[model samples]
Target: MALNSFPPGYTRIPTVSPGPEDYPDDTDALSRSSSPSSSSRRPAWTRSFHLAAAASLFTVCSLAIFSALSATRISLYSQSGHALPLPTHQYFGLETAAVPPCKLWGPGLSEARQNVEAVFYIDFESANDPPLHPDLEDVAVWLEGPARFAADVSYAQKGRYVVRYTALDAGDYRLRVDAFRRTQTGKPYAYWLPLGLDTYNVTVMRQDGSRLRGDGRQELALPKERCRGDEVGSRGRWVRCEDTPLPCTRYGWIWVPRDCIFHIYTPDELAKQDLWIALVGTSVWRGIFFAGVDHLFGPLAANLSAPTSKFWKCWGRLSAESAKMRISYLDFRQQCIADTGALHCSGGDYLANTEKMLGKMAQERGGRGPDLVLWESNDNSHSNYTMLSLYRQWFGPSWTGAFVSAFRTYSPEVPYTHQEAGNIAAYASRNPEAKVETLDISRLGGGLFDTMEFPLKQSATFHWHNKCDYEGMHSCSPVDDMIFQIAVNRAVERQRRLPPRAPTPPATEDVAEDIRFCLQCPPSLDFSMRPEEDVQCFAGLPL
Candidate 1:
């Protein structure tokens, strides 16, 4: 992990074992003090004299040794091996040598409708005296949301400072901590400086806590600091903005570069990552768009035998490296387990199925959690009511969920698409954490059914291949397949651009509001002819 080369025989040792004087350049000290012949001729007792008196010469020697002993250090743990190596003076700067690289800790999980524990650990670099506990007022811990809530460092013991915050509602949240010593004049500590900064994401739950997943006690990598200023005075402010302001993704769930909002993730970017994403819900996620005469029938339609295995094309052009996606289907009234290990049957058992998928996700690459989770609900559910509740439980009341409306239906009574524009507004009003706007495939209004002349005459059915030949074959038209591919591809692109879940503290507020506006909000489509239907058709259209 050390980026720079050391002396040919330089063996890496625990930093505490060496004093500042023990640096490899000690020969310069001997040269400056005495001639080489005289130094070599010096008695063994004289050399022993310097070693014994080293403690009285430089304050840094004692400070470094005791600092290493007293400092409570936190470490990162991840299955993906994404945690960045600790920065060192050789690679970063000598000024940073005294500052401990901030460690990010804890994969915080929310027990739905309960509380989320956001804990931060820091090394008290200068707290040498056990009798006096370090004053932490200068250290700040906060949860970012529409309104920032500062956390209290309520406990400190054994050189470690522990700050704990209880999440009030379910939604996504970013947890941040800033630690630094200050001068007597209230500025940052200049000499022998000690500073640590970190931020991480935390998801809280609103409903059955069991729906939440992951072992909350594991440590996650802290995000890399973006603004590593050498100066001491403004260290606090600079470290807080560790994440450079990137243009927020149009849909909100992902973070994209300022110039790539509409374009989303490029193929190259996806190809370079080692990530895992999970999709859990009902038939909508069970390769609904890939169902056709050429594919299998029912919920497992997309899972084909070797002879007809073309359904994987649903992912479109994305071919990222070491990327895995876990997809699951849950039926209405089915018993499902939540992340909290409780069983729930509401809303098509989404919570349970999602939790189950999380379990499967953990088993990948030797037990790691998914970087992102995407769930598709049945059309019959109210966009605002069901989505917001579910979003609150997964993300927290302050974090937002991405809304994606189903495709429009020709039959008015088919329980058609969500009025995305209206539903987005409604969900946002009640749940500000609902940050990601709905990706409405129905935006292709009239385009799918429009008329156009081509040099080669086209068929009346617009290349229609099958008309629901099998029970779960929702749409078999080649055109419909293209449309579905486009819509879902856009969704994947949005997710692909999301900043790697590691290297940054999980902070979920209206990140969308901070960087960009919704490029295209859901349109106010008219659904006047749709029949009054309270239930979702789970078994598919009559054959």
Candidate 2:
């Protein structure tokens, strides 16, 4: 959009199209020229000769044309807005509510595993960009705990407009801006923060002290202990005491800050979110879910594939946008199907190929075939009935066999699941001499930002994935968390209700499975890559 006017007031800002030459008075030109009357007065033969001589009269017509041009400039632009007869404001400049959009840099975290990390970036270069609250300037710094949503803050230097958050134990945390200044006018400065997880403003925290903030406004000097855990830089000397030093040019000081505080998590908050997910989730999906395992294993980032080759072609990409999905569909195939190099195939074939497709991920990975093999050595068939019965009960009274056709296939290799492994798990329970207690999968621990490839919304109880979304050919949108949570919570409950386990039909697919969804789903951050640039969960959308 172009400007309607400059800073000062002046409606005289008319279309100054007509030039001074177009408005020439021409009075002096007339005086110097011979008059037409004088030319007509010449004698007949002489006048004929005189009329021929009157060819100079062309100058007379030129004067009339110039006068008309000046009239137009004065008429058209003298007034505007509602005064025009035709549509006047169809493309008005100063009236638009929309602004140029800024791209949302994805969540910021790096695998180099440094002392600090950048979670995401927000571009703020638009007329409609969310205004920077004046309060932000007044906020000095602060600390936050689990109950608090604020990330711990630190200063890169005195004039920098940037900051970061840090902690010791890993989980989730959010950054908040709480600047409230008092003025004699009784006005307020900026004061807003997000309330819950739906905004995806939902944060993940850890204990590195090295955290989610960084700035080039580095200090020229470094404190003695600043480089303790960090390596010395390229320069012979590790410290540079000068201010405004070049970026990556030398090392600077680091510490925790104090306006950047936590929102404080409480048992009450969990109660507010409704802890019912724990009670019924297990009966939905058993060993296939990773959320339950996530709690046990720790944050997902800790267990991330280690090398660049292990990562989604981590070396480099064509762009900020391209890099986001650089891991092409072909690669998804090679890794899950063709590249049987080391059984990295999880979701098995059910994740990618249709159940009707030629191959079954379950057969390849799930006890060498899709169908469950019953062993007489296993429980006397009562075990199989127990599982199938529970599966049928959980599907409720309305499902067709569709659920088992799709969801039942081994995901990520049938999960080494007792239910899918069938009656044997129950028989194993019946046998007195089995060696181990039960399941012995890994634990969830390690670095911050540990997350599954595809995190599920809280409402998901259990559902089946077509080969396209899961393992068959490595299509993504992974939902290991929901299934994990369901199983674990059920296991925890079993501690209270021991075996002679109830029956559950493992195979079934239905939309009704999702019993609840967050009523306050934060409006999607379609703006994360657009103008609203930030989301509004607590403090009405910033600006």
Measured by lDDT, the strongest candidate is: 1
Error of 1 at 4 (Å): 66
TM-score winner: 1
Worst 10 residues of 2 by lDDT: 317-326
Tens digits of per-residue lDDT for model 1, 341-374:
3334453433444444334434433333433444
Tens-digit lDDT track of model 2 for 1-543:
011111111111111111211111121222232212221322121011111221110011122332343311211111111100000111222211232232334443221122234443334354422333333222212222222212222222322224243332233333333221222111111111111111133333333433343222232122222111111111111111122111110011111112111111111121222111211111112223212212222222122222221211211100000100100000011112212232233334322332222122122212122111111111212223222232223322322111121122122112222243333334335643321112211111001111111111111111221111111111111233222222222222222221232322221232112111101111331101121112111110111
Residue 434 error, candidate 2, Å = 40
For model 2, the local distance difference test gives 0.20
**Model 1 lDDT, full chain set:** 0.29
lDDT of 2 at 62: 26
TM-scores of all candidate predictions against the true structure: 0.28, 0.17
| Model 1 stretches with alpha carbons more than 4 Å out | 1-277, 288-374, 382-384, 391-421, 434-437, 445-543
Model 2 earns a TM-score of 0.17
